[model samples]
Target: MSVRIATDGSATTVTASPRTLTVCVVITTEERAEPSWVPQLEDCSPALRRALERVGLQAGELWLHLLGIGLERGAPTAAELVDAVAELAPAELRRHLVGVHVPAWRALVGADTLEAAARGDRNADAVLLADECYYGGRARDSLSLLLPLSVAQTKKRVADVLRRFHNEVFAAREDELVAQLERDVDAKRARSLSPDALITAATRGYVYEPEPELGRVVLVPHLAARPWILLCQHRTTRLICYAAEPESAPHAQEVRARALKLGRALGDEKRVLVLARLAAGEAGLAELAESAGLAKSTVHHHLVLLRDAGLVGMRGNDQGYRYFLRAEGATESSGVLGDLLAPR
Candidate 1:
């Protein structure tokens, strides 16, 4: 499932000078990958997975937001980042984890109310529920899970899960992962792209038009977030966790695997109809579902497959998610398959 975090910014043009922009990368597990993208992350630890599910934390990109916050605070290394979270006061840790879902949560909810909610004040909880930030289905669940617990209790559970995940899932390949991300960051830096272009490239085609209140945009490359970008806004700063670019050439097996993925995406009649509708222009989930003559849930399933195959991309707006075809992926499938089957 995709983890879509809402933002207050509308679709508008925003420009930033080099002094206001920062680019970096953070460490996370392949478990962060969307279901559509990887289907299965074989190395993901079963125990760690169980821990996440137990806490009702299905969206792995939530950790990416935590990592991005740490990166912004000068916790460059994974170990340092884990420490950063560990060091935060229990109340502050609760805010960071919950606020990652809701934009401008502090200003909107106020510190006192948040504290009250942590203390099991129903009125304070209602205030948070009424706020627009907590409106998303997942955001609602995130808040619900933590609201019942004391802030300190939430902190203990969150810290335990993060530390265990880092040690069991990310620590072994830390060097290799960091080196790959560094190469991508360096390559992007060398290009000297304009702010808009850099954002689009970093997000793999998401053209972010920062809001007027925003000043700094930090792009954090994440390997687990492939084919999907995670966005978090902290007042004036926007943290974009983008899919990391692979440093190595695709192996023969890799090429074939991609071809098979594309084939699966194109295999169904309803999905083909959905693609045809998207080919004409961008459409929201409802519109595509209508065009495909299927339930929104069924249409969403097809969209996920299309997304995983790299044939579709989406942009969020005030209205909701609007999806479009990735022309490059659609047009290159034949060549990908040909390369896979060509005589060696």
Candidate 2:
């Protein structure tokens, strides 16, 4: 049997078999910040090789399809990259092709453009979109609208407090400080509003909006893998969590049991789903419920169990709650799961 590995924020699907595994890295480069050129081509080539090696896939045994989109310098367009991938991909494997988009670039151009490029590939297996580096030197920031004046000032005040707190806890890295600031800002924002108002605002700004479609696009990066970890923004707050998949019988039972326990305790489907999804990072609820054909509500019930278990959490947004995967102390299972089953 062949195993399909899809990643978040990507347009290419990778299939691993006894004989071979193919990887298609779709890169769209622009000249806005730095001039017209491929920034990561040289870096990414070796990184891809190393990533594949770590995953037990060798360079020679794999087919590397590089789709480069040159933006603004008479370079390759998004369409060109798609066409190149289509042309290079083996017909049979193309049917199982996976798509990945680097989040840093995706945020600059917009996900719709990337999604449109992949639309022609009908049989794509999974799409991987990335927002930040998992290993954590500098965490990438997803796009967010500037807050209204009132909210912005309030956030600033909270951020100042958090900056100091994080400095004491972590260090002088601005990146880490910013993360702490975001968390504090979110906490304060949640406490300032009612749950209903928070939900409505968050849904409008991040979830349902058409222009950016931040919620959906943010989710794209996590779709390519087994356990999906979604780090979602809700207004001033941010959340991280595992979006578990329960496609198989054993997994489904485990998910249901865990979900039931948490659901009964929490009594909130949205909260539960957010937490459970965080726990199952890279394989969130939508994928898990794919086989069960359950309504979002039914699937959400399972999510609540983990929320109550304190294994998952939700942060308040100006509109709705943003879910997060709580990363507690390290465990053996955390190490064993590697990328797919690791806790957020």
Question: Candidates' lDDT values, in order?
Answer: 0.62, 0.30
**Top-lDDT structure, candidate number:** 1
Could you tell me every candidate's TM-score relative to the true structure? 0.73, 0.21
Q: What is the lDDT of residue 129 in candidate 2?
A: 22
lDDT at position 206, candidate 1: 68
Model 1, residue 193: C-alpha shift (Å): 3.3
Candidate 1 local Cα displacement, residue 121, angstroms: 2.9
**Model 1 over residues 140-185: C-alpha lDDT tens digits?**
5456665667778778777777677677766677777667767777
Q: By how many angstroms RMSD does model 1 differ from the true structure?
A: 6.9
Candidate 2 global TM-score: 0.21
Residue 87 of model 1 has an lDDT of 89
lDDT (tens digit, per residue) of candidate 2 on 79-155: 33333433443422221111123333244434554353234322211122232221011111111111112333323
- The per-residue C-alpha lDDT of model 1 at residue 54 equals 50
